[model samples]
Target chain A: MVEHMGAQFLLSMTTGIFIGGAAGYLGSLMLSKRMALVAGPLGHLTLPGIALALLYGFNVSLGAFPFVILGIILIWLFEIRTKLPMEALTAIVFSSGVAVAFLFLPIEQAETALVGDISRVNLWEAFVSVIVTSIVFLVLKKMYSGMVLISISEDLAKSEGMDVRKYNLIYLVLIAIIVALGVKMVGGLLTAALVAIPAAAARNISTKLAHYSFGATIIGAMSSFIGILFAEISKFSAGPLIILTNTGIFLISLVFKNRGRR
Target chain B: MTNDFVLKVKNLTVRIDSQNIIENLSFQVKSGDVITILGPNGAGKTVLFRTLLGLLPHEGEIEWKSGIKLGYVPQRLPFIKDIPLSVNDFFKLKKSSERETKEILDSVGFRENLKKKKIGDLSSGQFQRILIAWALIRNPHVLLFDEPTTGIDISGEETVYSLLARLKQERNLTMLLITHDLSVVYKFSTDVICLNKHLVCYGPPRKVLTMESLRQLFGEEVKFYQHRHG
Candidate 1:
């Protein structure tokens, strides 16, 4: 039994690291663009997709795919139709989305926590997450130049004849997709923490934008892997432990950075 | 004179937050025409530059016919410094030839060694020169500068103006320079526009900058100084 638990821990740790790395990349891109708050909303709103998929007898993650797309469309429409800033729109979507998920909750939800709950993510799930994370990272890397240009000044970008609107919407959708895929291992509540904390910590230390991206990815993987190990030893929830580790790193980085400045 | 005009603004008026910063301001800049836009600190010079670039909300038509692209040197260099952009990366943004970047930097009196250096690490004067080089890399047909010499020291200001003179001579580029530098105005400017939220004077340096006209533009506090050199 001890050996079996150890094997399960190793698999979870490996899966957690790859998914965390992808979250870090997404978060880094958002931070560079000064839009770090979008992560939480995107992550939470992913639940409706998972729930609806389960209701239809589909794979929970697969059901999440279309709902993620729908969420992106809704966000885009809100952006165009409403005067609200992106942050406020995301918050509204997240709260309403979570509330809607509660509506569909069956009495037995207390037992299963939703149909076919992903309490213990297996090797196949982990493998799929790793592949998805790699693809997301590669696509973002290729568009780094255009992304940087947009981040600095939209006016400059427009004068250069870049399609600023398309890039922004596409980027938002990409972020949503990444969050949707990462929902199972880290769960919705803590998934965005993996993205935001590592990137925020990296931002405090990195002088260059590119360096921040690289540093965030490294820090994210380390925290997730270490947190998994700690959870195994302490018999605590892996998700919360991973989040606490990231939060610790963030606070520590902030303290040291401020002191050095003084 | 026909060959000198690089930029032409017609009936230009810019509104910000319901306040009109520039009103019906019109002017022409010929090739190698070093035009100075002089006004008080808050007199809408920067707004006019941004307006002309179609960056800010404005009411006006600005035409640049030199077939020359514009290279902008913004007033605030501090904003650029906060980014971790290397000089090499700045050049890469324009996607210009390496030879062109080297030549432009050389003309601005900046060393090649600084290319790999981050923007924040450069000294004020060094950073200013690099910015000018960034503008020049576009091979601008007309150069639009918004108080390029604002925060620099005397020597740095002199270096920037001298570089402007050199570039103007070499490329016959039309330069629309905005400044509050009274000392160098007569010496460098071929034409000058005196503005106080509206166009008060726009013509040759000697004609538009007369004592009487200066008084009307700057009010009772206006002080006139005869150019010892020009």
Candidate 2:
């Protein structure tokens, strides 16, 4: 029994690290853009999809993906066609998603959708997780500077020859991708914490841009590794433990925060 | 079609919803000209700049000679004021080498020690310097500035204008700037475009904007609007 559990956790830990690291790296930019809270609504928007996955007994992330993609497209379109900001558009779209979710949510298996279960993955699932996480990270790394410039000044970014709207569409799509993959490691409810806490912690202690971005990845990976290990040792849920471990890192980061900063 | 003509605008109109922000606006720019755009607040000064940069959907032509690089210093960014972005990181985003970034910052009169300071922490004068530095990093044939010295101290404001003049002399860079101060128009501008949604006046600064015109402009709502916007 112990041997079986160890094998299962090896795959869990492997997949969890990449997802957490990718989420953390993306979160670094989102935090800088002041759109970190947006993931909570985006996550909530995945509930209808998660409910569909639960009812059909399919993989949960698969169910969550379509809803999130749709919601991001709506937010992206609304942002372009109207003058409303991303936060307002996201709230308007996702609250409706959450409402639609409860209309059909299966009461019996809702726990799996609400608080994620990482231990149940097979080898194929682990491989897919690793590959998707890798692609997401590379794409993000390529456009990181362009996105940063946009955050500082959109007109400046445009004058520098960046297609601001194209970059923004890519940004929204990447968030949808990560949120979908993240739903497996931490459920829809906790996805925001998964993305935000590590990046917030990195912000406190880092004085440079590169340091803040890369450090968030390391912290995210470390949190997932420890949380999964502890979850195995005791019988608590992985979502809360991972988020708790990340929260601990955030608290400790306060002590070492550059004293000159607020 | 002349190579000397850097920009040609033919009846540009920008409409959002039902209202026309800028209507039937036409102008031209020549190479190496320091054109000042003077207007009361909400006279579509910013909208004109955006239209020139091709950042807005508009009706009519905004023609820039092909392959002319453009740099812009916008009026304000209320969002970035609280974001914790350090000076070095901001330059790094422009892909400047460490030495290159240092040299540019020094040229703009920003000290080396302040490199570690978050841009949010900088005073308005310092932040204005940083914006100017960022715009200059990549050499551009044309620059569009919206109230470039609005927040700087009066003494610092003169220095900023002098630096722009120096760049204009050295590089022959074409500059178009919007200013609230009438004195700026008289002191530095080669040509002036006085705008109140449409072209109010257009000619050499001293030629078209004389004391009589200045008094007329200041006598009306333009005076009230300038103070409130400033």
> What residue runs in model 1 are displaced by over 4 Å at the alpha carbon?
A1-15, A44-119, A122-128, A207-210, A248-262, B1-5, B13-23, B40-44, B54-61, B77-83, B96-104, B123-125, B148-155, B170-172, B195-198, B211-230
Q: After superposition, how far is residue A6 of candidate 2 from its true place, in Å?
A: 1.0
Cα lDDT of model 1 by residue, A1-262, tens digit? 9888777777777777887787787788777676666666666676676666556655556656666677677766786677578778777877887787777755444222221233366778767877877888888887766776677666666656678888887787678767676666555555567778888898677656667778789888888887788877886766777778888889988986697568
The residue-by-residue lDDT of candidate 1 on B136-174, one tens digit each, is 776777777877535577778777788888888887777
Interface RMSD of 2: 2.0
Model 1 chain B: weakest 10-residue lDDT segment is: B221-230
Q: Which has the greatest lDDT?
A: 2
Instruction: For candidate 1, give the lDDT of residue B162.
Output: 82
Clashes of 2: 0
Measured over the true interface residues after superposition, the C-alpha RMSD of each candidate is: 3.2, 2.0
Instruction: Give each model's whole-structure lDDT.
Output: 0.72, 0.83
Candidate 2, residue A51: lDDT: 89
